[model samples]
Target: MLYIIGLGLCDETDITVKGLEAIKSCERVYLEAYTSILMVPKEQLEKFYGKELIIADREMVESQSDEILLNANSLNIAFLVVGDPFGATTHTDLVIRARELNIPVTVIHNASIINAIGACGLQLYNFGQTISIPFFTDTWKPDSFYDRIKENKDLGLHTLCLLGKKIYEPPRYMAINKAIQQLFEIEETRNQKVYTTESLAIGIARLGSSTDQKIKVGTLNQLLSQDFGPPLHSLVIVGSRVHILEIDFMRFFAVDKQLYNEIVKKDYGI
Candidate 1:
């Protein structure tokens, strides 16, 4: 049997009891290391789960997945992901491959940023299509995400921008400030007015961590100046459909409550 388990959003302890049991029962455990990351190291998880984990990078998962599924018909193999197994499309491909090989598969689900984002007080039901903002290069800036964000804003639905990260590269995670700068650059180039420097945005860093998690509510210009420590950051663009309760709740994290209220009133009309 092949088991694909979610490690939740934070550290080793965040794994579900069922996931832990599956890991223990498996003969070989592989940790998917590229899509997202945990707060703790692999050593910590090994100490807690009492099993040495084999690190699987992008190349191994995408190009050598057959090796992972090899002997699964006879031996139990566990493939672990940092968030919910289905959060990334790559894992879906893995499941498809396993099925093609006639390998029985079991998936254990857990909390991911897709749902845990509600912790910032935005209504989950109000979210539209989620988009990822990739790190821009001198000759390779992509503005496709801007169109999706505009489409969501047109419907008065919230936009959750999952910042991109290349684990193999230096500075693996995209910082909130860098994401804002990229958004600003796009806005300047397109001039669609989908969002502005004065628009309300929430910067979240190290989510699901008990102690290091940080959330800041402010404008794009405001957020660009503030520091969101470390990696694994996400940003949310407030839409016109924000509820009164959400405004009240977000006030707790606002950088400047009065400014936030004024912008919401001017842009979101809330």
Candidate 2:
């Protein structure tokens, strides 16, 4: 059997009990390192699970997957992903390949930012569409996600922006400031108030991790100067103001205390 296990969002301990059992039973374990990352290292996971893990970066996973799947039909091979197994489209393809080979595969589910994003108090049901913001190159700045954010803002729905990530480097993070600047540039070109520097937004970092993980609420312009720690981050553009519960939840972070009142004043139509 081939098992695709979700390591959840944080560290080694985040794995579900069932997933842990599956990991132990497997003969070989492969961890895909490209799509997303965990706060803990591969060694920590190995120590906890007592399983020999092979790190599969982008090149390995995409170019040399045969090595991981070679004996899957005869041996129990396990492929691990940081979040839920289905979080990335690549894993879906792996499943497709397994089926084509007549290998019985099982997907072990766990927590992922896709669903954990509700920690910000934004109604998940109210989100219109999710978009990603990639790094803007000097000659290739793209605002393709701008229209999607506009549509969501027009409907008073929320837009979740999963920030771009570049691991294996020293700096290794797309800062929140850069994301805000890109949004401002898009707004300037479109000459639209769909979203502005003062527009309410949230920045999240190391979401499921225990240390230094937080959700901060502020305007894009206000968030421009703030520092959010770590590489894996996500931003949210809010469309509508609803219950007081959201405001309360956001207050845990300084940005919310400093900005949400103004956002509520404007977005709530008070």
Best by TM-score: 1
Q: List the residue pairs that clash in candidate 1.
A: none
Task: Estimate the overall C-alpha local distance difference test score of candidate 2.
Answer: 0.81
Model 1 — which ten-residue stretch has the worst lDDT? 164-173
Model 2 lDDT per residue over 123-168, tens place:
7888888887878888987788998998888888889887765443
Per-prediction CA RMSD (Å) = 1.5, 2.3
Taking all chains together, each candidate's TM-score versus the true structure is: 0.96, 0.92
> What C-alpha lDDT values do all the predictions have?
0.90, 0.81
Error of 2 at 162 (Å): 0.8
lDDT of 1 by residue, 34-142 (tens): 7777988899999999998999887788789899999999999999998898775448778889999999999999889999999999999999999989889999999
Candidate 1 TM-score versus the reference: 0.96
